[model samples]
Target: MSLTSVEALTQVRARTLALVAHLDDADLERQVDPLMSPLVWDLAHIAAYEDLWLVHRYAGEALLHPDLAARYDAFETPRSVRGEIELLDAPGAREYLRDVRDRTLQAINGRGPDGVLHEMVARHELQHTETMRQAMRLGGLLAPGEPHLDPLTGPDGWLDVPAGAFAMGAPDGAFSYDNERPRHDVEVGAFRIARRPVTNGTWLSFTEGGGYQRREWWSDEGWAWKEDYDITHCPDAEAGHPDAPVCHVSWFEADAFARWSGGRLPTEAEWERAATWSQGTDPLQAVGQVWEWTSSWFGGYPGFVAHPYREYSEVFFGRSYRVLRGGSWATDSRLATTTFRNWDLPQRRQIFAGVRLAADPEVN
Candidate 1:
């Protein structure tokens, strides 16, 4: 017999709950500034979101609490402050989560599988998993306790990609955000991108050699961000190490570094082309090492049509955010698809972000 939605939900819930096992209340409550949420709030929000989107919205179930709808329906009103999640207090939180999961599964079992709903919930849950890891990192917890490759593995030993143009975005019926919509053709010229992301060792060279201090290395905006933040290299910056992937730098920062090194950041088209270079036959996804910052701004294509997930992308267009290709170690494998794109403001840095180098074919 096939596993029921309830059973799957149980499994997902178990995994989410397990993430908190190693975390104390302090860790759970800790906030990584304004960009991220407290783990306590994050966990509760995930449960509430599953209930709201899958169970109630798609499955046609009643809300557990009528008044709770507004709080849970945060796609319209994205939370800025990590509100106190009194509803998620220890025993009550677990019980509430179980209730939501069980009820949602029961509905799913009777209604059967809804492909769109399933995909959305799956993606949403995957996002939460990444948020959990970001929270862990913010809480100073990143030891895997087992084997996992470092973030900055360059594409040095990997297969070389031939020059070609490939279909970049989602086709029909794919659960893609609006930013990836109106699936368009992008011509990718021959180029060479590092197989893996840039290592901390490489990034440090630029920084230590006056990378941030030099005006020539920075763009107008990049220079402002540096000067405004009074940016200075930490002699003990963790990202300054050789093996670590360069983290904590903005897209502009990475771009400046790339510019300083006589290269340029990859465009969205180029990044996608490099990522899906071997799309049909390749088994290994090029994501999950780190969140690769692309030089592309988050914007709609020529004939873009907004979908239900429009807010996920279009709302932030022409704003401070930029396009980031590839998921990170903190990202869920489901969300780690080659086509998946993550975005944040240029100045914001909290997650496991790292830079990768791409060069023009002629330059290489």
Candidate 2:
């Protein structure tokens, strides 16, 4: 039999804890980067969110630790300043999480699996698991083990994606984030996208050929950012193998590279079409290797409605953030669906962000 909501929750919860099993108290407490929460904070916050949505909201119970809500609130406490806030220590946080989980299990037992909240909480925890994985990588933690399957390989050239009207975003009955809601038809023109992400070797060529120093190859804003940050080489390049996808690149940088290669970053629609194309066979490759940047700004579709997690998508629906499709190796598979939307500031490059070149269809 397929796993029930409770079984799925239990399995994901155990996996979340197991991801941090190697960390010591100091490691758990340490903030890997200004953009990310401390490991311990994520651990506790996962349970806290579960408690808030599943136990309290759905079950109509009072918050077990109402006092601790502000500390874990993403809006109330910015990630950069989370270290200054007083938080539960390792053991205490673990105990608090256990208590919340126990209560959540009891609540789940009483309730049926038809509620959307249960699936929401399960997906929410899985999202955090990906976040924790990113934190561990940023903190220079070692990989847990070798991947069971060999790394995927792709063809050398761009894949032809014929233009057509395609349904974008998640379809009905599928559990998707609010941002991917209100599935609509999008008309995408013919385009050719790279089969695989730009590899380290390709990026090295750009760097060696003075890609960063050439102001013309970059936008006005991109040039300013490049000079301000003094970014000469790829971030974390030392750790990347030649065949590994190049990551930690900003959208501006990716755009510059695309321009330099006589192409452009695929618009969000194009990226989605290329990613989800099932007419003949799957043309794209190396999708989940890294979060590929697109040329579209973060925004909502027509008839979009904010779900229970309003702040999750509503707060950032504007031009401030760029859309990134696909997921990285650090992302949990459950949270890496085709319709899943990940966005970040154009200047931010700390995440597992990368590039894919897209071009207009060739004329005969």
Candidate 3:
């Protein structure tokens, strides 16, 4: 049990608790949004998940709440039904967290090489903290971030990533998701990429430029989704944060913006190249503010194999999902590495996501 794990576990708990400190029992139990789970659900889910992995799986012990495991399993209990199900109340949930943490610390001392699993578990809690914040923000329980008094701006010019190949995924040195495994090299062509994610004010330019009305700027499916949802303004733009990165945007919205601006979204490969380039004259700015949508679909790299479990990555490899690069403000630092891949359906926007523009170099 390294001190690092202990610190991470303790620190993340404090952060999660602080995020919900202002909310009462009803706020924690409320569904908030159809797309998000109740805050209480997220709290108990974190504890149950940690106990499953650390206390039972790693420590070779019985689960503290064996009967409750099914209730917290994310896949088994989808977000839509979490609020309707029997779950621990806010007080019980908090008690569950403390009980689970006590056992996890014991596992740290009485254990196998628990560091990797600890990292995975800690990151899981970190991620759900963000998920809880999503619910809080939707329900008006969480306060907005610092206001952007002026329009958002970044480095004045786009970066030129010259054609080259580089290692494109996580290496064996640290803890990474199975999807980021087996680091490999890949080629990318010369392209121009924005130094910062598109801001709320800038995205307004697209919306007011008839981006939604102009069918030419959107794909057939994107257009259908736009029309179906009666979509109009970007969420952050409507929220009065003009200088912040435009958030809560779906992939369809991002692609339409890219097309309207005569630019394109970067493939995950191009995104990684720009983010990881060593001889770079400049680096992308304000990356962690929002999860930048990528043009790439979610899939495995060459010779990709599932580790720990197949459900984490293997089940979602298909065109049904678009890959997102860069981490959002809600993303944990440990899970925000350049190689980390976040994916969702093209039309989903509940998560904190934004866009960065890219384009091919002009052929002369």
How many Å off is the CA of 323 in candidate 1? Answer: 0.6
lDDT of 3 by residue, 73-148 (tens): 9899998898798999999999999999999888878764467898888888888887777777677777555222
Write the residue-wise lDDT of candidate 1 on 84-160 in tens digits.
43435545456667787777778777887676566666667667867767656665664455114364433353334
**TM-score of every prediction relative to native:** 0.86, 0.95, 0.95
In candidate 2, residue 283 scores what lDDT? 67
Residue 300, candidate 2: Cα error in Å is 0.5
lDDT of 3 at 311: 84
Clashes of each: 4, 0, 0
True-structure lDDT of candidate 1: 0.68
How many clashing residue pairs, candidate 3? 0
**Over 4 Å off, model 2:** 144-152
Best lDDT among the predictions, by candidate number: 3
